[model samples]
Target: MRFDELDSKMRIYETAADYCVLPGMYMVARLDGRSFTRLTKDVCQFEAPFDTGFRDLMAETAENLMTCGFRVWYAYSESDEISLLFDRDEQLFGRKLRKYNSTLAAEASAKFSLLLGHVATFDCRISQLPSENLVVDYFRWRNEDAARNALNAYCYWTLRKTGLDEQQATSRTCGLSVSQKNQLLYEHGLNFNDVPAWQKRGIGLYWEEIEKNAQNPLTGESVMARRRRIKRNFDLPMKDQYDGFIQSFFTRSPSRGIS
Candidate 1:
């Protein structure tokens, strides 16, 4: 048999099951770190629950994905996960879910490995939101998760620091409500409300506009021009306020800042 004929036969097994996202769907690619529990806590020894270094690394990695290929409009990160929002009209790789999944996971893993100076991996999945409201709900879900995780972290670490074993610490926080967890931190002289907003609510990355005065070389005239730039927001709002925040980015096109 000819090489080309044999190759055609084998390629079917590789490409036959490929799936593409349907048009008119808003796609959110979420990447989560694999085995990060062991990797961050045991191997790397990042500070328990949260570490500034780890947080910053995660932010940088998320930023990398934004500038990567697709026209990412919004990026959100919390815990060991990242979620990127792409325009509904995006047509990259013919909107193949497999391509987005593989490429994003590979890129995230590679970037993290480079930054950590060790091997790390990320797995990505796509969420096809039918409407823009779902996108807002999706991020609101993550933001709430960050708040819950933050409370659990502070509670867990407080117990651990009090000489409880990991198992004991986990067991103690099992039935605690959000208030109880906050009280736990309070009793330990750590105010949960005073904790950094990024720790409790996650951080948001989106575009903003800046204006600058420019001079026309020939006319010797000055003018104000607007440009778009990506801004990292640590103080994210919540509930309806947050919905309003996300809505502004989608609505306001005339106010983009100078990049």
Candidate 2:
């Protein structure tokens, strides 16, 4: 057969996609901390309670979670709490929320329990929410709670280090808020006031800004150009802004379907 004839019959482009598709806008994950704290405190007798080593451990743990295949960002709260953000568009992520949660929790429990020689125990819960405004607000509220708890925990640990018993530690730190935490730290020569505020938590900015600078998700024109003649404003990125949109689906469990 001639090369040209063979090439014509091969249908080389039939299986190819015309264009690339980007993934989801964002991914949000939260973990419960009450059990984590109890476990850590029981196991480690470090003077500051949640010392640098513990924090590093949590960071490593977050890195492990990232192995599930998403862009990951994490923050710690109250010595034992954590919040995770994942890229929403990764493959199988939407369907794997439960699997991810259960797997993370189980791994934490087993690893911590074993490493700490039964002195500590961990029980955890995980959840994912849409990255819309309402969900952002929810994340803010949750992180704020974590921040407040962190201040309290630090205060209690400080008092305990200064020779107060557990009861006294809790009592002395009662009613302390983030502002108070700053003042207390300032009194002791520390510069920064508090951890990042809960309101400041999560993915810092929205993708709308990025879309504003680039072509529209649907029409593929400058956003301002379209706005000049008609009053049409579309802020969200094109659904397939990234090639891995399937990961966002992991937030939704198969049993629960869409919520």
Top candidate when judged by lDDT against the true structure? 1
Per-candidate clashes come to: 6, 17
Candidate 1 structure quality by residue, lDDT tens digits, 18-122: 888898888999999999999998899999778989988898899889878877888999999999988777899999888999999999999989999989999
Local error of candidate 2 at 259, Å? 28
lDDT of 2 at 90: 41
| Residue 258, model 1: Cα distance from true site in angstroms | 13
Find the candidate with the highest TM-score and give its number. Answer: 1
Error of 2 at 113 (Å): 5.8
Error of 1 at 114 (Å): 1.3
C-alpha lDDT score of every prediction, in listed order: 0.87, 0.46
CA lDDT of 121 in candidate 2?
38
lDDT tens per residue, model 2, 1-259? 9999888777566424322223444445555444554555554554353355565455444444544454443333325544555444444434445555666666555554454456343445544454444444544565455445556655666666679998987786677766776676566554334433321221121111111355678987775531211111112122233112223323443421111
